[model samples]
Target: MARIRGYVEALIAELRALDDGDVWMLGGGRLQAAFLERGALDDIEIYVMPEIIGGGVPLFPATGLRLSPKLIETKALDKGCVYLRYNFS
Candidate 1:
């Protein structure tokens, strides 16, 4: 996988200029939240495990922000993993 390391603002600026292809942001909930807030996120794809771990990081934190995503697709993978795809409308 290719990687680019830079300040958050620079990274988001570069991401905003892309007109084609998919950009995948790995991990870092804070960064993801920033991108979502800046209108840089197109779709959110997540993998859900069966077991519940206590005190895990929140996907959408409490900032009075709301997103209405349409459920586009779902897949049940091996080892009780569920893949969900949501299109932000």
Candidate 2:
């Protein structure tokens, strides 16, 4: 987040030139929560892959933030991966 934080600061400057209708792509659910805590993000996407990760790095961590997700879409991607997008707002 250190490097990304620097870019986000840059974004704060360039955001003045935006049309207020642009969307920024971001990953990292936990970091998203941090941004939200700092009032940077309001909407989010939570994608659950079809295959289970066997004892690897986990996506969602215990951030002490709880939210109810509303299902927005589901998709079957390449390599037998199924994606589930939820509205975190």
Candidate 3:
């Protein structure tokens, strides 16, 4: 756990040092959870599809931490899909 945390910290530091406009974590709930746990995630974008498969990996896993990010934007896409954007408070 300590090693993982160290790696996460290093990764975030490197990302912050970059000149890129925005860093995106495409997928992986666990990975996202890691960043969230470390307070490294400034915002998050979630895309909701029309189909539901009943069971699948959660957008964020249970880490005993709760967050209510401010909803910045929402857009309805074609085929009943939706895009949600939120920023951490």
Candidate 4:
């Protein structure tokens, strides 16, 4: 666990040093949550579809961590989908 944390820290540092544009993580909720927990993620973008599944993976896992990010923008897409953007402030 410690080694993995070190690796994540290094990766975040490297990305920050680049001074590039946004970094997108097309990973699952668990992976995103990991970065969020480490204060590495500045913002998050979520896409909502118009389908209902009985059971599936959550957008963000239950890690006993709670946060209230400011909603930056919202766009309605085709097929009844919506895009949500939130920033950690």
Candidate 5:
């Protein structure tokens, strides 16, 4: 998983370079978990979509991960995409 570590390091470096008032929208739970397992993420969010996937690529792959999150905010969108924020505790 050297590639994953490189990505995590690069992302953390970019994060360290950001100002205090920047917002980064992170997607992919399993991908995020990879970074989180390396202690690279301090915050996370999951956007719930109204549309159901018939059968395609899975987002949250079946992984043995347990992440307890606190709902920080929820946004109701008119375009069938709802944004859900949570504190990755």
Candidate 6:
């Protein structure tokens, strides 16, 4: 497992070259939003924490950009955390 950090295009190219199973984006919601906005991601796995907080960062921060990801799978974890998997359509 190698971690590549550089230009987004470079990372996308490397990932495409690898063509291995699923590529996971650990965090950085801004970066994730950018990738999704640029059509560089195939699927997204979002972990929802059961809580209500004020003034938190938004997941999809791109202005005026909307994405409707198809539901692929969902897993309910302990402590009220739910994992939702969606594929870009």
TM-score of each: 0.75, 0.58, 0.83, 0.84, 0.63, 0.76
- Measured by TM-score, how close is model 3 to the native structure? 0.83
lDDT of 1 by residue, 1-89 (tens): 02332466678887679897788878666666667766778888889887776667677666666788889999999999999998875
lDDT tens digits, residue span 1-89, model 2 = 68877776666557646888856767676566655555555456555455566666657666676667677888877877777766656
Return the top candidate by TM-score.
4
Model 6 alpha-carbon drift over 4 Å, by segment = 1-6, 19-21
User: Residue 72's C-alpha lDDT in candidate 2?
Assistant: 82
**For each candidate, what is the lDDT?**
0.76, 0.65, 0.88, 0.87, 0.71, 0.78
Clashes of each: 0, 0, 0, 0, 0, 0
User: Where does candidate 2 stray beyond 4 Å?
Assistant: 1-18, 38-42, 47-53
**Which candidate leads in lDDT?**
3
Which pairs of residues have clashing backbones in candidate 3?
A: none
Model 5 residue 20 lDDT score: 88
How many angstroms is residue 29 displaced in model 4 relative to the true structure, after the best TM-score fit?
1.0
Off by over 4 Å in 4: 1-3
Root-mean-square deviation of every model:
5.2, 3.8, 1.8, 1.7, 3.0, 4.8
- lDDT of model 3 at position 68: 86
Model 6, 8-62: lDDT tens digits are: 7687778879957777777677678767767988888889997787678777665
Q: How would you encode candidate 5's per-residue C-alpha lDDT over 38-77 as one tens digit per residue?
A: 6666677666666666877666667676678678899887
- Model 6 lDDT, residue 89, Cα: 69
Q: List the residue pairs that clash in candidate 5.
A: none
The local distance difference test score of model 2 is 0.65
For residues 2-21, what per-residue lDDT tens digits would candidate 4 score against the true structure? 88778888988898898679
Model 4 C-alpha lDDT versus the unseen true structure? 0.87
For residue 8, give model 5's deviation from the true position in Å: 2.0
